[model samples]
Target: MDIFSRPQTERSPLIDFDFANRRLRIEGESYPEDAASFFGPMFKSLEGFLADVSDETRSAPISVDLRLSYFNSSSAKALMNLFQMLEETARGGVPVEICWNYEADDETMQEFGEDFGEDMEYARFNLRVLDTDVS
Candidate 1:
């Protein structure tokens, strides 16, 4: 499948989903006017990609990197949903690694990362502190 990408806007994050390489990255602020509308396509594409994973493909690892400077409550919900999908995929024998990168001095973001990482049952979750600011 072709790569799915969206450049970051003033109120949204950058989304790059490379299905063929099994790498997904989301960075920047995420507070789009309509959270559902902004994330709907991503959800659809991810669902399609997850559904297409086969026995032969399960050996390849899926890497997800999320570096968000800020996000609203709605965006947080969307992220939780995304994590749930990845967790499910990992539970089904696929190797899924998620790295939540946050600024070293940003306690809120660090806590948020911890909160998100706490629910993972199968996927590997890493909390990385960025040396510099993301914004």
Candidate 2:
């Protein structure tokens, strides 16, 4: 599949999904007025990518990086949905790695990352500390 990218906006995050390379990155704040509208395309793309996974494509691990400064409850739910999808794929034998990046001084974000990481059953989930604040 082709790469899917959306530039960050004041009320949204940057989404860079390089399906060909099996790497996806999301960064910046997320408090879009309509969370579903903002994340729907990404969810569709990810679903499509998962549906197309083959033995050849499964050889490489899918990397997911999330770096968010702040997000509303709706965005949090969307993220949970995203994680569930990736976790399901990993449970199916596909290699999936998720890294939640948070600023070192941001304890709340760190705790949030830890909370998210705890839900992984098959996918490798990691909490990464950012040296500098991205807020």
Candidate 3:
């Protein structure tokens, strides 16, 4: 599977899907005019990559990092779908890790991640508070 990387914009997040490394990261703010339109291809590519995970690949844990500055309700729903896919994949015996990164002061985003993590039953979810001070 090829790597999928997309540049971030005012309305969308930066997407980095390293299929070979079994790591995927999505960052930045997301309030796209059309959430589905922006995420449709992403979902397709991720589904394909996850579905291709074999027993050999299962040994190395697959990880997903989501660092969202902010996101609308639609984007949140899309994220839930993504998490659900990961949960299902993990349930199928794949070692999976989901890290939700948020700015230290962003209470809303932190709570959002916690809520999302609560919904995930199969995959392990970690809340990582990002360093807000940039030196």
The runs of at least 3 residues in candidate 2 whose Cα sits more than 4 Å from the true structure, single-residue gaps closed, are 133-135
Candidate whose lDDT is highest: 1
User: Candidate 1, which segments miss by more than 4 Å at Cα?
Assistant: 133-135
Regions of candidate 3 where Cα sits further than 4 Å from its true position: none
Residue 87's lDDT within candidate 1 is 98
Candidate 2 weakest ten by summed lDDT: 126-135
Clashes by residue pair, model 2: none
Q: For all the candidates, what are their Cα RMSDs to the real structure?
A: 2.1, 2.2, 1.1
Q: Which should have the higher TM-score, number 1 or number 3?
A: 1
Question: Candidate 1: lDDT of 18?
Answer: 97
Q: How far off is residue 128 in model 3, in Å?
A: 1.0
Worst 10 residues of 1 by lDDT: 126-135
Instruction: Summarize candidate 2's per-residue lDDT along 4-96 as a digit string, tens digits.
Output: 899999999999999988999999999999999999999999999999999887768999999999999999999999999999999999999
Instruction: Please give each candidate's TM-score.
Output: 0.96, 0.96, 0.95
lDDT of 1 at 123: 99
Q: How far is candidate 3 from the true structure (C-alpha RMSD, Å)?
A: 1.1
